[model samples]
Target chain A: MEILVAAILTIITAATPLLFAALGELVTEKSGVLNLGVEGMMVMGAIVGFAAVHYSGSATVAIFASMLAGASMAAIFGVLVLVFHASQVPTGLALTIFGIGLSALVGQSMIGVAYDGIPQLHIPVISDIPVIGEIFFSQDGLVYLSIFMVFAVMWFMNKTRAGLILRAVGDSHDAAHAMGYSVLKIRFLAVLFGGAMAGVGGAYLSLAYSPLWVEQMTAGRGWIALALVVFASWKVRRVLLGAYLFGGISILQLHAQALGIAVPSQVMSMLPYLATILVLVIISRDRSKIKLNAPASLGKPFHASR
Target chain B: MLPRLIKRQSPSKAMVYLSPILALLLTLLASIVLFLIMGVSPSGALHAFFVEPISSIYGLTELMVKATPLILIGVALSLGFRAGVWNIGAEGQLILGGLFGGATALFFYEKTGFYIIPLILIMGALGGIIWAGIVAFLKTRFNANEILTSLMLSYVAALLLNLLIHGPLKDPDGFNFPESRLFSDSALLPILYDGTRLHLGAVIALFFVGIGWILLSRTLLGYQIKVMGDAPAAGEHAGFSHSKIIWTTLLISGGAAGLAGAIEVSGPIGQLLPNISPGYGFAAIIVAYVGRLHPLGVLFAALLLALSYLGGETAQMKLNLPVAVTGVFQGLLLFFLLACDVLIQYKIRTSKKSESTIAPAVKSSIKSTSEVK
Candidate 1:
């Protein structure tokens, strides 16, 4: 019973960063721009956030600083792809490579620094409940915020006028232009939001999860978040489910190792990644179904020549 | 209103060649700015970045050594890019190929047979082909986006490689450092030069480049690939199957990437370490694009990129620069190249009234909500 509760808790903790990143990417893609630099942005966030916390000795400031760092990086991407009419695929990838390199260079001195992590906030009354309370209400504030952000994102996308405009820009920039929409501005905002969220996700890793800075510390969680965006089929609610599923797979590998399972620890570590690919394969099997939900102009660059 | 710049019917052929050079120069200028920001002299940094790495015999050999896998992967990627089939998972395929080829060599480590090395090479290529075939299969069967699928599969492959090295393939005699057993004498790639680390892999890369050039230019398959990439509808109208092209391109590229991975393990590293490739698969993407998906062009780009890798190490030792400079340069080069490529396809005209008209169109696309449906 304790193991079950622990597993659920592990899943939530593991999913938090991915949740933040995928949700951010989801919004970005929903606006019709595929920002492949999420991984790079996340790493930059992790490093910058860690550096901020290390220098200032404040976790709140670090998280906010990370958001700003991530947004700025996204803004650069926006300038390249949205304004300059650069190819989306390569530009996003270059942003990632650039981000990773910049982060690594900046993070060289911060290899072993430790930061005071954000504390878990347990809800009153619910804290005393058996397994459910421990699983749901006992995580750090970021975990709850990630969950709340999903609902918030879903509502914003479905209900808000701004969300509607963003979606319109993504669907067909030409038509949106005809209707007096600013595709570049909407994409810029989406990219910034995505980058900020990715940064927050990165902060969760350094400030909360490991509570220590390491070079390339986020590992491949950024890639996993990118995969989650695809697995979610570009929906806010599905991103939450996908993040949790991947998180569960990640935790399961550790649990399996602890259980003295015959599988190698290295192989176990690959579970989440392999599961992501498998999920992508399964989800992508029905092409027609996925095409309906995908942003039509997701990877196409908007060039206004008229 | 400003006078409109005359729109050329087509870009001059000389400009096509000049663009990449201009892009390279722009990249150097941008990197100099980066160095200045880092408080390093731009000229000294450029010297450290490009010249210092290839000045000595040892540095030149090291550059060649690093260039081997990159050349192979770049050539493979060029083939696919030319066909419009983006096999971004070459890194994964390479790892899997290394695992297979390395395992083969390890399996026969005690044998002093003549065929051991040859068998490893074949198995390495085969391993890559099979790995690539997975992506090809998915694309054909499900109409999956090859870019995301292949790229995602790479992480899984890397993890699987890590698992194998730390578990079943763990070096038995060594302390518990997650690595595979060293290849026996027969399994090791014979060094070409006595004093240098340069091996048969470099020769193999050049050979493949030549072969790729021929295949891309002289073969019917090459024409089909080019047609499919440039005009997919026309290719279909001409009775060419997109599925066939995708499979062919991915398999060929995957096989090449796998071969490079195998060669790295067997020839140079001699063992399967957890992170054997410092993102060679990913780096090859830059090499492929920077080379403009041409075989001979990829050869030069590969050598240049390899210099960056070598320069990164030299910079690390001499100037206290981080190794990330190589990545930064590669990314910057690609960014500049892509920026240059935009000029190849579209001519930029700056007219006053036209510029204002463009801004509103660009702006309006961000405002309209009714167009989403």
Candidate 2:
């Protein structure tokens, strides 16, 4: 039972980043712009967040620094895809490559650097609870923020008037354009929002998760976040579930190895990736489900020339 | 008001040729700023980056050595990209090809036969196809997106390579290191020049480029690919098979990438390591785009990009600049190129009288909520 609780805690730490990133991307896609630069933005956020904390030693400033770095990366992507009307897929790929390279260069000085992690909340009564307190109340500020954002985004995307405008733009840009909506403006803002979320998620890696700087430290978590957005079928609630599910799978592998499973460690590392393929295939099989939810203008470049 | 962009009746030929040059010049300017930030003399840094790499004959040979794999992969990927098939799994395929080729050499350890090298190359090419075949099959049968599947498979391939190198393929007497024994002379590719690593692979890459130019410009399969990419429904209606194009392009790209991998191990590397081909696969994607997805263009682009690899090393050693500069340059160059390509389609007209044109968009936004109501 203790093992299960520990595993769950590890899973939350693992999943929170994915949830933050996926939630941001979900909102972006809902607005009809497909930004494939989540991975790139996340890495930039990670490096910037680390450098900020290393210099400033303030957690609040670090988180904000990550968001700005991610936003700047997205702004580059925006210039290419939005203003210049470049193909979204190629532009996003370029952004990611650029991000990875930029991070490597920027974080060169921070290599082998370590830091004190972000602090966990210490509420009075909630801190005294038995299993629940250990599981939830005493978690870091970012974990709570991530959970709050999930619900907040759910509310914003579903109940708010501005959220409808974003969704309408994504569903059909032409129709949205016909009605006089600035498709590019809405999509650009959505992209920025997505980038900021990805930034926070990336900052979590350096500030909370590993508590150190490393080259390409986000690894393939950014890609996994992208997959999570799809696996959830672009639904906010489902995205939360998908992130945890993947996080669970990831920690489960680590636990299996620790418990003396005979599988080679390299092979064990492949479980999450293989499972991603499996989940993707399963999700993609239901074409209608994907079709019903995926924004019609998700990846298509909105020319606005018409 | 923003300058009104008007669509050209036809793509500007001048922009098509001029954009790459502009992107390169812009990249040079960006490099200057990057250098200034690092407290280095921009001119000296530029000299080290662009001029120092190919100033030596040996450096030139190394440039060709790097260009060989890139050109081979780029030429092959161009065909697939043009046909609307995303085969990002070239890296994985290359690894498999290298693994197959390396395993073959090890299988015939100490064996001497002329047929052995040719056999290994063919097996490597075959290995690439079989690896890519999984993506083609999945996309055709299950309607899966090749982009995601191919990427996932690449990770799997890397792990598979790690597993083998650490276990079965570990050098027998090398203290449990995760690498294979060096290839016998019979297994290695013949050298092209004395005192240089340049080998038969460069020549083979050139031959593939020539073949690619011919296939793209003078074949029915090439026409079918273009038609399908531009209008899939129309191509389907006209009896062109979508599945056939997908399989064909994926196989060709996979085979080419595989051949590049085979050549790398047999020619320059001459043995398998845990990680082979430092992202020649991803780099080739940029090569294809920067080349405008043309075979001849990819050849020149590959050489230029290969120069960046050498220049990066030069900069790192001479000025203490990080080698990550190459990746930054690559990404930046592609961004500028993509942005510059916009000039081909739209003529930027700075008209003072553009206010009338911009009025409708402002008015229509206020009307959007009504339709929803």
Candidate 3:
């Protein structure tokens, strides 16, 4: 019972960052831009958020500052790929490298500093329940926000007019331009949202998950989040499921080590990445199914020559 | 006000020469800004970054040592990229090559014969070729995106290395550190000079660069690669098999990357450890591009990038600067290069509603109509 409870709790915590990141990436990809700089952005968020809380002694400010920083970085990427018409792949890679370097350079001083993170909030009746309450209703505010954001993104992408325009732009930028929609404007907004969400995810690491800043604290979570987007098939709800599943795998590796499992840690560490690759290969095997839902102008630069 | 229009042009001879130099100048400017933000004097930091590394013998040796793998990998990456094949998994290939070659060397530790080193080198190159062959096969057979697949496979390769070093390949007598047994003197790469850590790998790297240059400029295969990259349909019409090119490019590149990895373990490191690579595979991608994906250009670019790695360490110890500054410079250089490349392809033209615009506009409209048809 205790192990099950612990696993469930671990899943939620692990899922939070991935959820935030994948949701952000979904928005970016939906706008026909693939930003591969999530890892870099997340690291910057981790450092800035840690610095904010460490200096100001406030979690709110740290989280807010992280989002701003992330959004700003994303904006630079948006300008390069959207306005300057740079190749999306190389630009995205450059953004990531820039982010990683900037974060490491800035984060050197804040090593070992701990922040007082946001505390858990529990509902009255739900808090009193046994296992269900402990698992579901007792997470910190950010975890709840991540779950809410997932549903919010689903609704925003499906039921809203802005969502429709965003989808139309992603499906076919030329058609969207022909229909008098501002493809660049919609893409800019989507990219900004993605950047901000990625920032929040980074903040979750420093402000809540680890409560400390470490160089490359996001590790390869950004890459995992990128993989999760493909695994989710670009659906909002499925992103949540994929994130939690990846989170579970990550946590399982940690717990296995703690329990003195005989399996090599390196092999175990490869589980999440290997699983993601396997999922990609399987999904990509039948190209037609993927083509059905894939964004038509995904990763291609759109230039209006009117 | 009228929006400025730009006329696209074929790349000129002068611009081709100027692009990299301009990119470097922009990178330096960006680095100065970065140094200012980090509270270091720009000139002093730049000196520490570039000049100081080549000043002392120790630093020079370190630069050469670092450049060995970079030169090898950069050459390999240039070959594939010139043919328009993006092999982003060189890091993984490098790791696998190191593991295989290192294992072979260790296995033959007792048999200190004349042929041991040669055998290990061959095995290392073979290891890299096999690893790259996986991506090549998938790409040719299923039309899978090599960029994503190659990159993802690198993670698998890394994990396999980690598993080996920590588990089965762990040095038996050593304390709990995750590393393989140190290679014997017979297994190790011989030093080139009397005092420095620089070894035969440097010579090997130069030899490969020469070979790469010859193959790219003079061979029929090289022409096929260029044509394939420039116009895939035209190459197909010219009777070049896309699958064959894919296999050839990946195998050659992968073998080069693998050879570098093997040399790395045998040379400076002398042992297999958990974190063997400092992202040499990925960094070589930048070096390849900065070199314009040309074999000889890759040599110079590799040295410049190698200097950054050496300088990054110097800054870390002397100025208390973060090592990530190296990565920042690399990223900045790539960004500036892309910007410069745009200028190379397109000439900015400003007009005030004049006669010149009418002719170009009419031509563009005609081209657009034909393109639509």
The residue pairs that clash in candidate 2, if any, are A32-A170, A180-B364, A180-B365
Best by lDDT: 2
Worst 10 residues of 2 chain B by lDDT: B350-359
Tens digit of per-residue lDDT, candidate 1, span A1-306: 988887887888789999999999999998889988888899889999989988988778888999998998888888778765677877888888888888888888898776668878777989769887777677787887888899999999999998888899989989998898878788889999999999999989998988887877887788789888888889888898888888888776768866667776666776776676678788888888788989998888776544
Candidate 3 at B20: error in angstroms? 2.1
lDDT of the structure predicted as candidate 3: 0.85
Per-residue accuracy of model 2 over A1-306 as CA lDDT, tens digit each: 778778888899999999989998898888888788888999999999999999999999999999999888988988788888888888888888889988999999999888989988888998768778889788999999999999999999899988998999999999989999999898999999999999999999999999999988987777788888889989999999999998888786778866677888788788877888788888888788889989887888787765
Q: What is each candidate's DockQ, to 2 decimals? A: 0.65, 0.66, 0.53
Q: Tell me how candidate 2 scores on lDDT.
A: 0.88
Each prediction's TM-score against the native?
A: 0.92, 0.96, 0.92
What's the i-RMS for candidate 1 in angstroms?
A: 1.8
Q: After superposition, how far is residue B252 of candidate 1 from its true place, in Å?
A: 0.7
lDDT of 3 by residue, A108-200 (tens): 888877566777877999976889889888889889899899889999999999998999899999999999999999999999998888988
Which one wins by TM-score: 2 or 3?
2
CAPRI verdict (incorrect, acceptable, medium, high) for model 2: medium
Residue B206 Cα positional deviation in candidate 3, in Å, after optimal superposition: 1.3
| Model 3 lDDT tens row, B43-71 | 98998888888898877888888988889
Steric collisions counted per model: 16, 3, 0
The regions of model 2 sitting more than 4 angstroms off are: B353-373
